[model samples]
Target: MLKKSHLLCLCFSSTLLSGVAIAQNAVIVNGKAIPKTQLDKLVQKSGQPDNPQVRDQAREMLVTRELIIQEADKRGVIQKESVREQLEQSRVGVLVAAVFEDYVEKEGVTEAELKATYESMKSQYSGKEYHVEHILVEKESDAKAIIAQIKSGGNFEDIAKAKSKDPGSAPNGGDLGYVNEKSLVPEFSKAMVQLKNGQVSD
Candidate 1:
């Protein structure tokens, strides 16, 4: 009973309304669905084209990421007590930050208050900054031996890479990079502050 134009309009409106009710899915990876919304957001964030190539790339990335996450979940990675505790701590930190941000937005800070706070804390910031490399060992005897090697023209970094027990820095040749004087332990601070540049601690 409808005219051709009216029938076409009705069909288009029905499709439009249905689109509002249902989210377009981009892919399903191992039963996990990646919605078009996710792809759109990623594309927008990446500033990429909205074309088929970009969409397909997004789908591939989403699938890969989701599978890894699923594998981690299946392995009960999140079930460990330490991980759970850390996760709870991270959640608490985020919530606290959000609440603090909201409070600051609602109850604004005055320039005078900021100035007073800065004045009260300014003295805490001053300390000698040391840029040095260190090779740590369990025993003082071992440390002395390493220092002797360095003095005898052995490469400090190569020695550190070979022998430092501090796993994080050992791979990078025992570089602690720059550290402030107060941030170190009392013994280390005292020893390091007195050392001239290129001097190793004995």
Candidate 2:
């Protein structure tokens, strides 16, 4: 036989306690417990509105990520040989890059040093580029004959396709892309440099 006021107070106390427990159990991020706050922050950072549709999409994405992480954990993917190897490689790469960066900073690469290096090694870099066609023959004699045919206004590409031993260049009509002196063998490069543009050689 509780009084009406006492009964009301007891009910109110129970309700308040339950609310406090719920609040305590709730997870918070950035000192905020409201989902909308979280959504707003995400939207702000991403430059997109977390509308109902977007929220639903994000929820699905989070759920999928969680499921993947859970499955990975269960399957010990993090401890797998392949995964560990990849991680080790990544770690080594990062460490090497960091060390190189530190060394470069300490050594101080100057503009003058760079320019000097470039100038001294200019011949190593300098070369004439050519786009030439040729016929590759087994004997120097056959090659010489092909060169003669070319001098007599015969089509270099046609001759190459007809008699070139090199399968790779034969199909392309012996068209080698723009190659420089450095790109060719010593003898080949010397011969190439002696020729003018569009000139064929043995």
> Which of the numbered candidates is closest to the native, going by highest TM-score?
1
In order, candidate lDDTs are 0.76, 0.65
Quote each prediction's TM-score.
0.59, 0.38
Clashes of each: 0, 0
- In the range 59-128, model 1's lDDT, one tens digit per residue, is 6677777776676687797898867888999999999999988988999888998899897666545655
lDDT tens per residue, model 2, 1-202: 2465673221111111135544442223223233434444554576667576776565444444445555566669889876788789999999999997898899988899889989867866676567766567899888788878889998878888899987668978887877767767898878888888776655
Residue 70 in candidate 2, Cα distance off native in Å = 39
The weakest ten consecutive residues by lDDT in model 2 span 8-17
- In model 2, what lDDT does residue 96 have? 100
Which candidate has the highest lDDT of all? Answer: 1
